[model samples]
Target chain A: MFIKLAALTMLPVALVGGVVANSSVMIVEVDADDVHIIVPVPLSLAQVAVAFAPDEAKYIQMDSEVGEYLPYLARFVDELRAIPADAMLVEVIDGSDHVRVFKEDDVMRVQVDEGHGTKVNVRIPLASLAAMVDAYDEEENMFRASRLVGALRAAPSGDLVHVIDGDEEVHIRMW
Target chain B: MNRKLLSLAIGAAMLLAVGATAQAQDAGWIHIRVMEDEGTSVNVNLPMSLISVAMELAQKHAFDGDMDFGDEFDGHVRFGGRHDVEIDDLRRMWAELRDAGDADYVQVQGDDETVNIYRREDTVFIEVDEDGDDKVRLQVPFSVVDVLLEGEDNELNLVGALTEMANTNNGEILQVNDGDTTVRIWIDANPQG
Candidate 1:
């Protein structure tokens, strides 16, 4: 009888800064001229949330089908890891935007400059990205997010992304 | 005789009330939340102890401690090639699976659909994914299965299963996401949330 009442209710979804200090956490902060927000989420909670996400959010689809490139993800990451840090993977200047993708130390970094105090920077450990990619479940056609959560526990801790756009600034860090 | 029966009813009710109050103070709660994108949402919070008290009352009055449900569900419980097995056989298989510990039992993959049945620790999970329109995840503890299968033929011990669930830790039991609508059932310690 109680289970039948499920159609009549909803849940509180937002989770912020509610985990142990030593646990792996992802912090997202947005500071604008008008508003400020910060959310610190544990990786375990992220995995649990994935279980509640729609299928579209679980799988990464390309032109032909979902996870079509899964088989080659490891190989691609491996090749990238083998490249020298001094090598420039991609550099483009279009209009006022300047983009650069390069290997630095053990991680790959991408920086985008839009001029006038607008800049976007992303740093990701190649190994950690590969670990996340390996979590894909071939049978389910989706990622087994729990595995990704487990992998994130050992990932290098630091700022993942930082962006400054005019009067707004956003930062994402994992630790 | 009427007076005696009335006194017994009052005593039982009072006993249940006291027990429920004591348990509710410490026991966990079961929470269910369902929502739809750009639509109304609902949240239901039920005390685990309250359900336990109700189940105790039900055991004394309705089920009478019976747990064996008949092995004739007359339904198809698909498990790869062993899709058409009997209920008793399925239980036997479950026992085997549980003994073997955590591992994938069945995996069915299609062009636009997939189903996975696996066991993790003391729980079993059945997950179904059909493109972007539908996704369902079912999680049940091993004890719930044992209690449910204890009933006599053709009957499931739903009461026992629920009783076992009341004892389960605050964790997720089931979740379903279909397009705009999402439903989740979990247990926690907060009675108000």
Candidate 2:
């Protein structure tokens, strides 16, 4: 019965920017039942290390040889992996590898795989997602999951969500 | 008493009296008319002495600092002052500001318009832009700047000076002259309440 309800309430977001599908490395997918996150390990790891550099000049110097800062990058990744899945709104899978999670009853199962990419997949219940969305105020301007839900509720069928950046626009369609 | 000596004394006294009258005329007052886009106009009669006082107050408070006195100062200047200001005291205060800073300027922003007055390098630059569409710019030369800076002591006509500056710079007296809003600044020779 819960599975059927989850299927009915599922929200699928399709990223339309060319960067998301091609050049951009980060991807996050959220639905009523689960959440999936993926990133290129080396590129993301290098970026994390560069943020710790002392100053702008040092950051520039470290950018050319990002691999030299692997020890610092490893520590940062370990800290993120240490966070408990149950304590978070969405469960996070394995610390170093392709992370996967599944929602069974009230508990969520998570797994991490050591591969070229960092992937996190977690299961989330529909009721819990609704509760999270309900916490946001209607008048707030910041883009949040609640705003998306509100838009979805108010919009008719086949409405489009447009994300504008400067002159560029990325459109997401909802059915 | 010698008749010739008495006549000479009277002539000298008459010449002194005429010189004093001429001096009083040179120290003239300023009249300002501000018209808004809403068809509402405000007329302000400011004695040259009052302008000096306001300038001194602005300097003392360091009006350039992070204080938002745009509306208050605008209202005070647009309307007449309640008290009289000493011309000499204002001049002294202005001298201090001039020596301390290279320039002084005032910026007034309304709902959809902005007016900027910049005094720099012995020249005053006024720019008014409304709705980010229409813009009026003027540069007041040193000669007029000197007259304004030395208020109440010079023979310069305040209205004539400003009109000439606008004409010379190819700028309009009205800052914003659009259908939605019109802002005009006029200097008059006669005082009006």
Candidate 3:
């Protein structure tokens, strides 16, 4: 049976919470036919405030002016939550220093620092994902197949991590 | 040297340069739009020159590594070796099978039954039969089939045909209604002089 390509419009939803100050990292792996995304989520408001509060100065002022920071933090969390979980079977592995998030039965795992961030791992079929994304926006569809493979090919061996600006809509890095 | 001859030659050369630039600007483009009943739509624009460049690049790297086409049209067509053989290889294989008369209908093994693919004149038919019962039959035009078959060769014959049709037929290239979704592709040519 031919699968119908549908647009995926589910944005991340916000989990009600306060903001905390913390640091965190996200990792993603793109394979031949699948994509694995891993993100660390901080449970506490202080950690969430610190990890995704736009910037350090704004984060400092967040405590003084709570209203201005709450909405931004909520939006960030919502975007993170918007990462599609339907296409993946998720598992959360909690540790003392870090949390490990991965797809069920996936052998690959990333170590996370404890109390730093929450880790979320999602595995998606690359072809299906590309088709779905293409159904929505053809111009951006190529990134799923072409740019992804090119980036994976160019990535150096070893645990290399490159941090882009945190304020970006999707702040994912490869490790 | 005669000044008149020199002036004429300079003027001719400038005219040729301008003609070349105009030709470059007049090159055709394909626009594909997919729409669903749910009010979701997507638009894609593909330049003919870019497709030509990608075809050349694919030919160049056909034996080593992977050749990626358009970013939005995306995906790598890997060549060389058995393990990395991609859709391009499969197309050639199917075409050869058809040529050899062994594939008037190709049988695909399913979980509990067999699916048969055969061509009837201009339409390719896919029929699924499970446990001695006919399950499903689908007929698709040869135009769409040609797109898939000729895709391995990096030729956009279907798009070219659509471009020609759009040029003549009031900008309506072709539209296919599969269930509730409609897919339309046309050529938005550079305005004529």
Candidate 4:
């Protein structure tokens, strides 16, 4: 049951968040209308549960042609890790709504603010993102489970994503 | 009589100098220079004879090193991947190209990129020109590449490549310019290169 919930919540924030190297717990919080939910998932323990899942759901299959581009992708990811702090990668503004994507210190951040209490925030550690890409295995054409765990393990405690839509809110944090 | 003797001495000295230069041409040194706009630079020179001796010693010790060496190309070679042309196929293609004499082996042109691969004299050249100030120029001697493939099946011979590189004459082997950084590799008799 915990594995199913963890896997369900894992996809969006798998590429984000971090804390101390020792911090391995992820907290997911969601509040909507009259319902409030909070779940603290231990990443190390959750991964072990994931493995017991049936074979078909175990791994995502990658295209065979991706084998040739693995090296280039790795090199490109390495370059991404070197992006300087406070660098602005993207920005868009329309009336009162503005979307800004930038790097701050060790993490890349995406923030969308559209007046009132409606806002979205995402923070992804560059190192952990690089680790996520490193998880890919060319021979097997799927990401390695250990490296995926490593990506989350390497992240420093931080908010992976936060969303506020009038009365509804969803936030994912890792520590 | 003194003037005639001096003229003979000068001629003999010139002949000896020419002979020494020809000898140096047979065994040259390889050099690499990398300079970046960020103010970092590197210069390296390797003695071909030293490499030859080291390779010989390694071979005696049964050291193959297991470096793939790209197996090389006269035909299609994907390079640095599992799908690259096999060793035997490379050798076969090389043999055919060697006999076919110097000619353009491949040319790829796109709006933002261009690559020219060809053979001239005893050298095969691979040149790439990409947008945003990226470029590469590489020339590997036919002999050196052939030596690299002389190993047994599914293996590339690093020692043989070193030996051939030692024998080859002085010339530029490779150069790359990307944005503000430039890298150059060449060969000459100078250990200070």
Candidate 5:
């Protein structure tokens, strides 16, 4: 009987459109230094590292199309081979040869060991990026930015933290 | 009827107060519109190396103004590629621009005579006059390094103007593989008319 009465009371409210729903959005200010890479909106952290890092990264090239080595070319290739293929986002080689990664508008493809064996391929939809953010050209050390990924990274020398808002809001020190 | 209306109003006020209190506990920020002013606009692309140096100089011995301590400094540090700038960073940039552009435009003979030949955008202006005199004037177009800082300090606006003048056509803009990800800046020079 109590259940019936509660249902009846709620029925009038429901019919009268009294139910209200509000969504809350959180704005977070992340410090740049902690970020390893900052790509346009659609690009992920892995994509950013692949896209922006110096041509001679610890295991990646700086250029998106033409791969070049500035300082640590050979050792970088050796480190790539050391990583297990399955454990990595981009596949690994025989720990001897060099690999090159390339991307199109929405698709990212990797040529492993210089296309000797099974080349790893991954494609990120352009829609996922919302809109392209900013690209860093290693040829020039300056930064260009937009609303997407504003700055590449904050100065690691400085004390800055990343703010994340979700189930539990917190500050992450990327450095 | 009047009493009922008053009670309803009081209830509404109480609910508003509760909602505001709850929001204070929530993790969020309110982005306030801070600047909406216009000045001379010049687009220049200059050598980043020289600008960086000059900015460092300006930071050390630049203009000093009194500002209310409690006011909030709010503005975007816009980047096109991988650049970063901070509050402290502006001082350094100001110093660098002054140092780099100082020699480029002026050659001083002791204290009395100086030549001012500066470039703005793709255009260069040359003026000859005595030191620190209004008789020296040059107007040119140049793209400045994008540093959009705003607050009571006005440091960002002042430094941005200097960077825009210093970086103009110095061959700093780099070529990108795809047009998709290049850095673009839209300085909010006040609101559009």
Candidate 6:
């Protein structure tokens, strides 16, 4: 009876999630409503659970933000995606430091600024964004690098970070 | 007689100077862009036609590298011969290309679009556009081009290709793959070795 109940419960979840061909790489299809600040450490789920157990409040905030702005951001992301098709709004907790810009064709107009030491500017023209992304990949030695938040998540514990300097130097920082 | 000898000496020096200038003009610059799934990088001063021929040869001989030549163009010819042999020949051929009297810029097709690469012995320079040299400049500065030449996660593979244009860099959406350590790449250029 217990087995039957478990199977019945799992069946719907599996169907809803879609039967992914390979379970090794779990491809989660997150819509706008599911947006969240994801810490992309290469840690196992158990390790992640242990590390994040004390940060339940942080997770809650992320979830709430995702729930509220995901739809709007998704639509917004889609709209701007035509030109800068690969550009995305990475939901991040520390994005307070980033500047936001909106692009009209090749022109990028800065929309937001928190006055962080670094230009926390968002809203890049597709061309500039493409150039930046390309420079980052060549600098970081990756086929492609994610946005700044994704970079942060990848090396959460490391203070030494890599950034493209004037689209030339991949400056490695000790902090 | 002394003045006459001095004039002859000055003429000889001028002729030598002209010879040096002519020698400098022997090699022309070509722009080569190496684009991958992640992004595109513009390399300048490279003999575009020579590299284009090398790329053609690699395609014909199936030479494997960070940037695969086959998938670059629609009408590209596949490299069917031995990889090592063909790559060596192409490299040799590239070295032999004479740049004399050619335009300072030769546009070559990268893995994606046509890019101009300025070739130099130690570094390759790239500009955004022919005219906008002041606005954009990138040096082929990496010392480890080998990493770019050979990689399992390269764009040639299905996964990398699919994810090539998947995400944008405007600090918005983050695709957190809790698998491999994801490197945030800005430019799509071969790793310099």
Q: TM-scores of the models, in the given order? A: 0.38, 0.22, 0.27, 0.40, 0.17, 0.18
lDDT of 3 at B24: 27
Isolated chain B TM-score per model: 0.54, 0.34, 0.40, 0.56, 0.20, 0.22
Instruction: State the local distance difference test value for candidate 5.
Output: 0.31
Which runs of model 5 end up more than 4 angstroms from their true locations?
A1-101, A104-107, A110-175, B1-75, B78-104, B107-154, B157-193
Interface RMSD of each: 25.7, 31.8, 19.6, 19.2, 21.2, 18.3
lDDT (tens digit, per residue) of candidate 1 on B55-126:
333433443334221232121111223325455675677678778988998899999889899989988887
Provide the overall lDDT of each model, using Cα atoms, as 2-decimal numbers.
0.61, 0.37, 0.38, 0.62, 0.31, 0.30
- Residue pairs clashing, model 2: A94-A112, A97-A113, B37-B182
Ranking by TM-score: 4, 1, 3, 2, 6, 5
Find the 10 residues in a row with the least total lDDT in model 5 chain A. Answer: A19-28
Q: Is candidate 1 or candidate 4 better by lDDT?
A: 4
What's the C-alpha lDDT at position B44 in model 3?
A: 44
Measured with DockQ on alpha carbons, how good is candidate 3? 0.01
- DockQ of each two-chain model: 0.01, 0.00, 0.01, 0.01, 0.02, 0.01
How far in Å is the alpha carbon of A62 misplaced in model 4? 2.4
Model 6 scores a TM of: 0.18
Candidate 4 local lDDT, residue A118 = 89
* Residues A1-175, model 2: lDDT tens digits: 9997776566222222332233213222223224323323222233334456455422222232233233333332232233233322122222233333333333333433344433222333333334333433334322233233332333222213333333333333323
What lDDT tens digits, residue by residue, belong to model 5 across residues B1-193? 1232234334423222212222222321111111111221112211222222232222222312222111221112222222354555665654465456433544555576566676544444656454332232344443332333333232334334433443453412211111111111221111120
List clash counts for every candidate, in order. Answer: 16, 3, 21, 6, 54, 64
Model 3: how far residue A2 lies from native, Å: 89
Worst 10 residues of 4 chain B by lDDT: B69-78
Fnat of candidate 3 is 0.00
| Model 6 stretches with alpha carbons more than 4 Å out | A1-175, B1-89, B94-116, B130-136, B142-193
